[model samples]
Target: MLKLSNETKVGILTVVGITLLVLGFNLLKGKSLFSHNKTIYAVYKNVNGLMPANAVQVNGLVVGSVSNLEVKDKDASQILVTLTITKKIDIPRNSVARISSDLLGTKTVQVDLGNATEYLQSGDTVYAATDGSMTDALKEQLNPLVQKLQGTLSNIDSVLLTVNAILDTTAKGNLQDAIRNLNATMRNFTHTSASLNGMLDPHNGNIQKTFDNLAAVTGNLKDNNQKITGILDNAEKATGALANGNIDKTLQQLQQTANNLNQTIAKLNTTDGTAGLLLNDKKVYNNLQYSLGNLNKLLEDLRINPKRYVHFSLFGKKDKTKPLPSDTAAVQQ
Candidate 1:
């Protein structure tokens, strides 16, 4: 190898320094000189401060950078932006590249992947959109609130004017009196709150004692759960037994008995049967009465004249006193 002159060596060093400087600058700008990156295009009405070398992110991760921007038409009505993706991600053809900004106003191209099996080629155009910047978003969010606040202020102004128109010296005095009453009501409410707090205190309150008593009752109920269950089970079994009994058959029997009794009563009300005749026929009743009287007299006679009825003399003589009614009947004959 031939040795170089000082000037040539210096020139070579200068070129090498320049090349390294360029490489360093590109690296700082997030560009890989040797990277096999994919290039895609997008058209937008506004880029919203998207610059070349701005980070192109996919799901919040920086995968590439914005490469170039150019006005698409003579009127500058739209812009064409070029994006370089260094990763091997399969971006769908329908994917959108939205220009977004952070809180610090650092803009980025956020890639929103789409659901399509067909992927974008290196030179394909992605759909472009501009997300509202932080300021724009804040303005959009606060506009309604501002409108409502303005309306509220106007309504309050109107109310103030109305109050000024309506409130004379006497009305002002009454208003002051009302405010004083409200303050007193507030004081009363404060006292009531203190009383309620006292009622709710755990150490000294009747409410707390009532709660403790309720807790003890619940504890007792829980302790006697088994006994209560047994009682309920026995009651349920008794009710089940009653439910399963032949109540319909018993009712049928009772109804049949009532029917029979009713038939008996009906027969007794008629003079067709002997019982009916006895109960319902007056002639039969009189005859029965007479027969019962005769029976009673016969019984009394036997009791009084037992010797006439049963003669048992040892001398074999009859009771010859002329049977009681025989003499009287013979004289009469």
Candidate 2:
């Protein structure tokens, strides 16, 4: 074994140490010195939790890392971040760089390559975007809820103050009185409920009888539904007949009959017919009365002198005895 001098040993150690340091620094920046890569720039208003050495991925595959970050403008409102991508990765012209975080809050840069045939060069620029992490998202969403909770708490405090002021007044007596009234009302309601329960208890037949009667009525109605429908149909038919001039025809016929009767009464009153002559002519009436009186006298004479009418002679002794007109007249008188 050859022994080296101290200066030479120190020089060799320094070179090895510098090499290790360079390798460590490259590893910390997520860089592989052995592999070829390209660099691109992205400008953003906010990088949100992005840091150097964070993985730059395309479609969830690790392609590069965030190399460096700086303020693009003097106002420091805009940040320009450098991304070192693999040389073999062909990024399209319209690619987008977005900063996102995982569930562990580890930030990353995700590249969404467009479908354009034109590709981005090594020193091309990209527009930067940010996606809120779980914490930031929750904070943004819960901000209104927090404000509403604060308002609710403030309202509750005001209500408590008002309630305290109310309790400090002599109206507490009225409140207590109202409470007592409410208790009394509650007791009365309890009694009413008990009484109602007694009336409607399952063992009691009153409610059942009512239900049975209702059921019976419903059954009767159901059974007689066709009969009722028939009656209604008949009534509708009658109403339709009345509405369709049947009643009018009846009234016309009645009117015609009444007119005929009125004409007959006029004829009777004017002595233009037989009934009219008999009812209105006094001379004919007197003649009828005299004829009836003469017929009655003739009938009476026949009944009294039946022997004169029924005379019989068996032998031929021809002695004829006849009734005289004067004797008949005298008898009539």
Candidate 3:
């Protein structure tokens, strides 16, 4: 190495010291001097306290830092921010860089990833957004609730005013009476509920006893299940035999017999046969009645005068006596 003067050595040492100091200060402020990072841009209406060197996060992981911020328009209404991402991750073109603040009021740019296949390149502009501050968010959330409360208060005020207007002496008395009746009704309902509870008591209730009886019946049925099954099997076999037998032929014969009987009865009713004529003709009935009466008289006379009907003696002696007048009259008739 060449020998250097004291002034040159001192100047070089001072320059090195200054550079090292600058690097250390930037590192402490979350900036890497020799980082392999890409630069992207975002425009926002407000940064919400975002500053240079603030952390740029993707899903809460710090991947880079905000590099710069500047106003975009002459009116200073929009701000343009520069971001440098050190992480070698693809950020989509439609990704949002939202400036969000923590509870401690420190702000960072949170990248909400999008589903675009085309990714951002160096100097690309991402969509920018600003999350509401804590106070602003609370105000936003409470606005509708406050309005609802106001409306409810107004309705309550109107109701109270109308009630005050309507509640005169008689109406107040009627309301009191109605309240008393409601109380009485409530008491009655409570009593009825108590009675129902007692009636439904498991220990000493009729319903419980009925349920026990029903359970006992079911138990009895369960005990006789085999016998009942056997009876049912016998009944089924009997019915099957009847079904497999000539039941249709038997029924047809019975139906034919019944039809013949009905036809015979109809013919009897119309005097179409001898039996029908005997049942339906009055002259034949009268003649049969007269013949039966005469036969009965003749049998009665023979019973009374047995000597006239039969003669039996040891000697063949003829014994004759004058017949009775009633017998003669009967014979003449």
The TM-score measured for candidate 1 stands at 0.49
Question: Which tens-of-lDDT digit does each residue in 26-87 have in candidate 3?
Answer: 77666677877798999988787888889999999999998788888764778889998989
In model 1, what lDDT does residue 71 have? 90
- Local distance difference test scores for all models: 0.90, 0.86, 0.89
TM-score versus the correct structure, for each prediction: 0.49, 0.51, 0.45
- Cα RMSDs of all predictions? 19.3, 15.4, 14.1
Worst 10 residues of 2 by lDDT: 316-325
Q: After superposition, which runs of candidate 3 have C-alpha atoms over 4 Å from their true positions?
A: 1-174, 307-333
Candidate with more favorable, higher lDDT: 2 or 3:
3
TM-score winner between candidates 2 and 3: 2
Model 2 residue 148 distance off true place after TM-score fit, in angstroms: 4.3
**Range of the 10 consecutive residues with the lowest summed lDDT in candidate 3:** 318-327
lDDT of 1 by residue, 222-262 (tens): 99999999999999999999899998999999999999999
Candidate 1 lDDT score relative to the true structure: 0.90
| Candidate 3 residue pairs that clash | none
Q: Runs in model 1 with CA error above 4 Å?
A: 167-333
